[model samples]
Target: MGLRFLVVEGNTRGARQAHKQAYGLTLSESYAEVLQEIEGGAVCDIAFPADEGANLPDAAGLESYDGIVLTGSHLNIYDRTPDIVRQIDLMRAVYASRTPSFGSCWGLQVAAVAADGDVRQNPLGREVGFARKLTPTEAGRAHPLLEGRPAAYDAPAIHLDMVTALPGDCTVLAGNAVSPVQAAEIRQDGGVFWGVQYHPEFSLGELAAILERRTDILVREGFCRTPEDALAYTADLAALHRDPTRFDLAWRHGIDAEVLEPQRRTREIRNFVEHRVKTEKSARGRA
Candidate 1:
């Protein structure tokens, strides 16, 4: 069987446009072409509403897919909407079924809330610039997905809220002074659940564009002082642009590098597999 990824899109219109513009995948196309080049067979389904607030597709509907990935959106999970509830329900069902699941910014927080945790407006407004330093826990160092990642790596941060506390048995994989729980992994559950505060799917230039476009809003909301400051803060952004190996080396020694390299690792697949095997076995027993 081939690996499949069930993508949970928050907003069909915005998500579709993002995929097309950033990854060059149009709404009309199966995510095959773009995903194959980026993640190969590791990616599968890309779920979305044919229109807004449509009923969520069923979980068994996605049985052919092996894993779940929740897309980021501007909406808060706590908002009262059928779509939010449906997405939350689907995520919880994925957990109950032990499906391998991963989430980005908003997706991460939503997953945490669905697992009996909490989400709130961060006391610290928006983390609009590059968070240059993130200290990993011992488990983080051992985590295959995070291992070989710099002791501290920079990520282009552009979120108003974050996962303040994680679900039970969830290990904080990466953190810093500003955000105590930047990355987390729940290994004790039947299906491993992983979430990152940063956008792993985004490249540096893309991240910059996001911050650039939202500068005024970020400032008005007190997420940052100014758009110019956020974008011109090269030290952090430059560090974020570093390749995984070099970034890790620089982070360990606190030395800077002239150029950064992109880091690509398939750790997500490993974590996804771990969850899938556990969930499949559990589902079989129940059957």
Candidate 2:
């Protein structure tokens, strides 16, 4: 049987609509596209736990999938609002179901909170665009999730909240100077989750859209001297996305093959499907 996967969108209805408007695709849609690209013949279903009245899969339903992916969001998990609470509940159910799971950005924060960890606004300020110099820990170097990752690398990212306290059953993987818990593996209640604070699923165009949306914030945060500068930077990112062969644009932004090459940029997501999802599916006779 072909692998079946579930994509849990962490964004609310409004945020998702905004994303669609700005990026031309909802976060979940982008995740589904990337998953299909990574594992052709794999099928994906999307769930919106953050939207009120949205139907979510129960434990049995969750267990039926070969793997689950949680997408990033604009909501703050620390707020404990109804929408946020619903996502937390769904994550707990995901854990109980023991399905192999992966998350990015807000997805990672949600998983952390559901597993008894904590998240807070980063004191060092928002780490936008690319997360730089992500060095793997000893555990990460040996971890399968980062099997093909270099000693130090960069990935597409944009977030202000970070995991402040880790769960008891989690192991820190890779971290950078900005955030100490960039990547981790959490094992709880027979379930395994591999997550990263960066967006391995994001395309350069998507990053440009996000930067465009947050132009004012980028300026206020001192990332750019003015909105025009921010827009100019995003234009360059979009241009590079249109044509990756633009070495001048790549050099201007100090970006390398790690962020420019699709395979290298999404290595973590591919690793999860191979090392966790496919491995477990085979062991369970579902392969």
Candidate 3:
């Protein structure tokens, strides 16, 4: 059987913009890569609540998955909308269950807020495009997932708000000058939980589309004066994408190392199981 995973996507925006506006990786390519890895011989299912307005899958229904993953979104967790509230509860349930959960971008904020942390817009504003360095703390240096990683790592980032304070039990995993909390993990015995502020899921093409789609917002926010400037910025990213090795050198954790393939693969398996768990029981009832 395939691994079961419960993927909690924030809303339709997360689904629609994940590739073009967020990670910069094509949805089909990213989803296919993940499905191929997690499915292996078993089934893998990626679930979303449709929109912020849609109801979440029941907690009982989510309990069967091996792990869970949270996707980034345009919505803010601080909002009182029913959909945002539902997502917060979903994240809370995942944490309370001690389920292995991974979060990216907005996913990181969701995890932080659900765990009693704080998030706010950085004084530096939007950090769209790229980061050439992510300096891990001493604690991060000792971490299993981060050990052997470099003192500085480069990754693509896009966000206005940054996680400012972490919960009591969480350990920071990565950071940079603009955002102090780049990634983190909860302290638990034999449990898995991690969150990254950047989008490791994005490829260059996907990132450019996001910049293009949000051109007006960027201009209004003073991120760029004109479309041409935005295009130039995105173009630089495309060059790095074409030759990842140049930028890979700066990312501390050896995200490009062959050794980490095992860890990445393990994450894929866990995610697969978690996604499947959320849907397995429903499928069985029909059987």
Candidate 4:
């Protein structure tokens, strides 16, 4: 049998609907598409843990899947709302199940908070559009997840909250000046989670759509001097998405092959499947 994967969307129904309207795909849908693309013939199931009364897999049910992926969310984990609580509970169950898991952006926050770490609104402000110059630590340098990454690279990102305190069993992987916890590996209750602060599944077009929707915040937060400037910037991103060969636009944005190349951007996810998921499947006699 092919690999079976679960995609846990961290967004509520309303947020996901709005995201679908703006980006043409729900976050989990996009994540699932990427997973299928990476691992051919893989089966992916999506669950919305943040939705009220949403059905979630228990530990035994979770063990049926080879791996799990958590998607980014617009909600803050610190609020501890009922919806947020549900996601945390689900993640804890995942840890207990000892499943291999991976996450991005808000997903990373969920993993951190669920593991007894802390996440807070970044005092330095939001790191939107792209996280720049993420350098791997000593551990990350030798980590299989970052095996193909360069000494420093950029990736698409948009987040207001960051992990401030790490759990005892987590190792900091890569970090930039804006966020100290860029990428990490968390081992809790025999379960392992690899996560990054940036969105590997996001394309320039998706990010452009998001930026267009958040133009007001972009201007208010000084990411752009005016709404027109924000729209113009997003236009460049959209244009680049249409034609990645536009080196002029790439150079203007200082975006190199890391963000421009799909394989490089999603190296961690592929690594997780190859190193963690496949290895576990083989160990369980499922491979």
- Clashes within 3 Å, all models in order: 4, 0, 24, 0
Q: What digit string (tens of lDDT, one per residue) describes model 2 on residues 1-287?
A: 78999999998889999999998889999999999999999999999998899989987899999999999999988899999999999998999999999999998999999999999999999999999999999999999989889999999999999999999899999999999999999877788899999999999999999899999999999999999999999999999999999999999998999989999999999999999999999998954
Candidate 1 per-residue lDDT over residues 125-164, each given as its tens digit = 6675555576788888887557556677766456778776
TM per prediction: 0.73, 0.98, 0.74, 0.98
In model 1, the runs with Cα more than 4 Å from the true position are 12-35, 49-57, 187-189, 221-260, 264-287
Give the lowest summed-lDDT range of ten residues in model 1. Answer: 257-266
Candidate number that wins on lDDT, 2 or 4: 2
Candidate 4 ranges beyond 4 A from true positions: none
Better of 2 and 3 by TM-score: 2
Candidate maximizing lDDT? 2
Q: If the candidates were sorted by their lDDT against the true structure, best first, what order would they fall in?
A: 2, 4, 3, 1
Each model's lDDT: 0.61, 0.95, 0.63, 0.93
TM-score, model 3 to reference: 0.74
* Structural RMSD, model 4: 1.0
**Which scores better on TM-score, 3 or 4?**
4
- Model 3 — which ten-residue stretch has the worst lDDT? 257-266
* Candidate 4: tens digits of C-alpha lDDT, residues 179-207: 98999999888889999999988999999
Q: How accurate is candidate 1 locally (lDDT)?
A: 0.61
Q: What local lDDT does model 2 show for residue 268?
A: 94
